[model samples]
Target: MRPVASVSFDDLLRAHQGMIRAFLRRLCRNDALADDLAQDAFLIAHQRLGDLRDTGAAKSWLFQIAYNVYAGHARKHARRRELFEAQNGADLDDAAQPAPAGMARDIAMAMDQLPADVRACVLMCLSYGMSHSEASKASGLPLGTVKSHIKRGTEKLRAFLHAYQQA
Candidate 1:
């Protein structure tokens, strides 16, 4: 990987855009929002390109930015959802919404049950094939915390899937 100062924005975007979008889609389970957030992430990356010190770590750095974007959106959405529910005297649970008809509802629900940090760590490591160190960097979590999250997250996923299989 070339240094950040040497790499073109187009090249970085071309290399990472799809993976970033896919990761966001899995996190949010919303295609449009994921696409929008992916764009937002790229924009942020472009602005911060000068800050990148090690080009070899670009992927983890990009994931970090993307994860931050998703986290910010999740926080904003949760607050708005809470206020809306309070005003309407109603409760709404995003996670309780059924998966798309043909999707694996059990897996989706299980993943949704994870806290955001845990899910992000698990997905970064398992879904994206990132190393533990990379996942740690991407999630901005300590290395041990990232490993612990992956262990706990996978356990929950396995138990959930096993129960689903039995039913």
Candidate 2:
């Protein structure tokens, strides 16, 4: 198979847009924000295409860029939340938008209840179908850590949902 260098970046974008959007949407749980991030990813990919030497790694490379964008966005929001909490003694969850109704919504809510790191792994693996190594590259986390997070996250989600169901 040819490296990603062999394909036009536009062609790459056309081919991967839906998958990228689905990955972001599942991660963000917001369609508009996911679309925005997908656009951001493509723009970043376009700018940095010259830097990548291995065309075969294009998909993973793009995912890593998207993950970086998401991480930056999350950090910015975290800072804002910290400032707000310091000022008003407000909990972050107080401002969280409610989850929508349905099985997906229920699962999303369960995911939300997990620790952040574990939630990231679970979503990357199960929700977005990213393999452990792929999730590791995209998250800047060690492979073992990604594996452990997915394991721990699975246990936690199962427990949480079982409890939620009994209620």
Report each candidate's C-alpha RMSD, comma-separated, in the order given: 3.1, 3.2
lDDT score, residue 136, model 2? 92
- lDDT per residue for candidate 2 within 1-167, as digits (tens), equals 56554778878799888878876766666678778988998999989888677776676777788878877877878887688899989645344344579876788777767766677778778876778998898789999999999999899888877887898
Please, what is the TM-score per model?
0.82, 0.77
lDDT of 2: 0.78
What local lDDT score does residue 101 receive in model 2, on the 0 to 100 scale?
91
Q: How close to the true structure is residue 53 of candidate 1, measured as C-alpha lDDT?
A: 83
Off by over 4 Å in 2: 84-99, 161-167
Show pairs that collide, candidate 2.
3-55, 3-56, 4-55, 4-56, 5-55
lDDT by candidate, in order shown: 0.84, 0.78
Point to the candidate with the largest TM-score.
Answer: 1
Candidate 1 at residue 14, lDDT?
94
